[model samples]
Target: MESISPLQFLKDKSILVIGATGFLGKVFAGKILRIQPNVKKLYLVVRAADAKSAMKQILDEVYVSTS
Candidate 1:
């Protein structure tokens, strides 16, 4: 029997994330980053009226703080 580590597979790999503002998407993206901080690139596709709003959504909705 053999087991491949998911983190190892994602390390240094580029990932594209869509609907980053959504619940599942945000959680998935956050998990990926937390698990594999060394990922080559994390491309996020967000829908917004403008770049500013998109940034706000990502910061406020996607990324949150416990403190």
Candidate 2:
């Protein structure tokens, strides 16, 4: 068995992040995007049960900082 960095795992792969609207979740999402912008796309889980809010979170936190 060997260890793999998250960036490596996410390289050219689609990532689905559950509970990614919280404090820690946001951090993980940020790291993935910051290191691997070309990792495909991110699917963030949220309690709002709608794409609008979920998209907002991704845009506000994950995408904003990187840009």
Candidate 3:
């Protein structure tokens, strides 16, 4: 018998996450990226003045702190 890791399911998959700036959403995003580094993509939908600001916020608040 062999055991399969649940993380395997996420490999090479695209994920769209809304409200990623919130507490639980941030936790979920961090965990997914940390556990499955090979995930195809992570689309974080955030509310901001513009696309640039959204990207900056995600980079600073999520990726920077988590990584």
Total clashing pairs for each candidate? 0, 0, 0
Candidate 1: where is the Cα deviation over 4 Å? Answer: 1-3, 65-67
- Cα deviation at 32, candidate 3, in Å, is 0.6
- Candidates in order, TM-scores: namely 0.83, 0.64, 0.82
Q: lDDT per residue, candidate 2, 1-67, as tens digits?
A: 9999876787889888887767877788888877888887777777666878878877777566545
lDDT of 1 by residue, 2-67 (tens): 887998889899999998877788888989988889999998889999999999887887778211
Put down candidate 3 lDDT per residue, 1-67, tens digits, no spaces. 8886869889989999999887877899999988999999998889999999998989888786567
* lDDT score for residue 66 of model 1: 11
Give the clashing pairs for model 1. none
Best by lDDT: 3
Query: Lowest-lDDT window of 10 residues in candidate 2?
Result: 58-67
Model 2, position 23: C-alpha lDDT score: 80
CA lDDT of each prediction against the hidden true structure: 0.85, 0.77, 0.87
Q: lDDT for model 1, on a 0 to 1 scale?
A: 0.85
